[model samples]
Target: MKIGKQDATYQLERFSKTQAEFDEHYEKDLQPIAEKLEEERQKTMSLAKEQAKKLIIPALVALAMIIFFDGFRIYVIAALAAYGAYLFKDVYEQRKKMRVKIKEQLLTALIQFLNPNFTYKPKSYVHRNQFIKSNIFKDDPNRYSGDDLIKGFVGNDDVDANGIKGTKTELSFSEIKAEKVEKYKDKNGKTQERVTTIFQGMIFVVDFNKDFEGLTTVVPKQKGLKISLPRFLSGEKGRRLEEVELEDMEFMDKFTVRTTDQIKARYILTPGFMRRLYEFATKKREVQPQNTQKPETLKEAVKVGLNVGGDQRRASQDARNVAYFSFRDGKMYFLLSTGKEHFESGLLTPINKSLVQEYYEDINKSLELVDELNLNLRIWSKE
Candidate 1:
């Protein structure tokens, strides 16, 4: 199998010539282009940082002034004002950030929806061995306004260690619970063995009765919202929690919704952000004033509201009724419009049902596309 030394030498020389040519070409051509690109990127970043510094100069000036002025009360007031201004700026920025996140989450969902193989319509999809049917929430033209439909499914139940059998009171909210330690298929071809519950009957229709109306109630002294969710019956009681009152604070609304709609494999949007910027930009907008028509109290901080003058502005004391279909985790979050905002208090709300409907319908339409394209993409990736 051994070859002669002369033949080997000839092969080695040939290889050396090719290697030399490759090194020369790559260094002269590809390397320069890559280096130039890197340099341009650095320059762009440097310019951006410089611009940011210039924009922030006023904040620095305010800080320096506060430091220079030594009178105790004056200094404190000045410092507080400066900090407050910064806090306001930060809040506006954060709201915009949240909006962007929401947009991303929605885009991802829409992509998922568009795909036929992964996510078809809610109803008539094959789930494992079972062929189940589900209705797309938006597809139903007769959908109710608010969460009145969801509210009917909450009540006291006889949940024991053996498992939830039935409800104590014969109410619509008391749903017939279902368990899954084995395997079950939902209508959309999703296979899961996790224990879950679904509301039964024509009157009651829902699952995961948490934050009933998607309306969050803030805990009395806590910064977070207090949400109430039903505890499903699981086998074998633990040390203490198996025998607590249903109204126990420990079993309250602690589960935060996947509101942060950031998606790497989808589009997203944030709410109540751009409007806030517009508010701050235009100082002291004339809105509905209280009884006195003047600022007599402290709580009426809103300076923007109903301007009953312009027709195109669409000024009305009452906000329009709308609906919500928030998709998070693996479930759809639904909400109904409660009422319109009062026209007097500059309370423009989600009153335009048409606009809200369009948003919801568009999401439903886009979802299949999103699912088809974003099948294997990482859910939480921002990029």
Candidate 2:
């Protein structure tokens, strides 16, 4: 289901209908598993409570004895703690394994219900090299780690009855974390090392149906003190790349476009295409109220670096507002800092109809970007 300008509403309606069917299937199929999980959870909780109750009195008694006899205080506390750990170790391990199993099962079931063709890996993730090739984030490949990768096609591979051709788009998203160690001095003037998060969010990659050899990066505009910084100091190496300017004032105001070739950038970022990017960025900002509370206007949003992808050297840059865009090898990668965990099944909450609807909506939101950004509408490019 390609969501075009004229049929956005209709595509959503169709998705809603499909989601309703999935919801019914979920209730019918997953209810038994949910019930079993609930039972196991209650049993685990009861066992933990009983174990804690049995240990608390002894631990308190040991503490009181230590206060009276200072000689054996350390030994007494250590003994009590060791004993408590020994008592609960098996139960804790058992519960942990059970939870992992349940989580994997639920995720698999939910993903299958959404689309039988799709595959969900509870432990796999998008590779760091892929992130670098995507040019979404400017962190060292050694610093990147990710997990929980979901990949598959959405919509139909065949043409639908409405005369609309279904897109065979390959979509994948994963939770990514990139960190670097910084050496700094504390208040006491002693040098210390601290780990800083360079990028922590979901990185999404979609196959763009068209193949292009050049790289086009659309980052947020930089101004003020940042503009005066040297390329080396700024930690960005693509200064030699031509900065292409689009005709749309709003898009130009929102994004700083760069490409290996100026003509290719212009062809890729058409007025209609830039408008779609602007709209997507605007929608993402609006969804995150915590970050966009002060920016009331779209221009202000862009000025504050509301779009993804910004100057990597700006330490004070807000990761939530930044998204990185990269085009390479017939694929479009979008690095979004949503600042929250996604596709997680709750421990206590069952996978209900509403929950399934939310998952469906999120998947569609990602897929729609392929069409909305005009990724398939290639110009001056060979497929």
Highest lDDT against the true fold, candidate: 2
C-alpha RMSD (angstroms) for model 2: 9.9
Candidate 1 residue lDDT tens string, 1-383: 12111224223111011224334543554344434433443443344344335435555565566678655547666665565445345433433343343223332232232221222122121121110112112121221211111121112243457653332111111111122244778889899665422211111112322212211111112233122221211121331112111232321232122222123102221122112212222223222222325544322221121212112123133212122223322322222221221111111222222222222332332222122222112222222
Off by over 4 Å in 2: 1-6, 9-26, 62-81, 155-167, 182-193, 221-239, 284-322, 343-365, 374-383
C-alpha displacement of 104 in model 2, angstroms?
Answer: 3.2
Best by TM-score: 2
Residues 283-366 of candidate 2: C-alpha lDDT, one tens digit per residue: 753232233346775334323431122222122334444666766656778877655445543323343454445445555555
Q: Against the hidden reference, what TM-scores do the models get?
A: 0.18, 0.70
Residue 266, candidate 2: alpha-carbon lDDT:
69
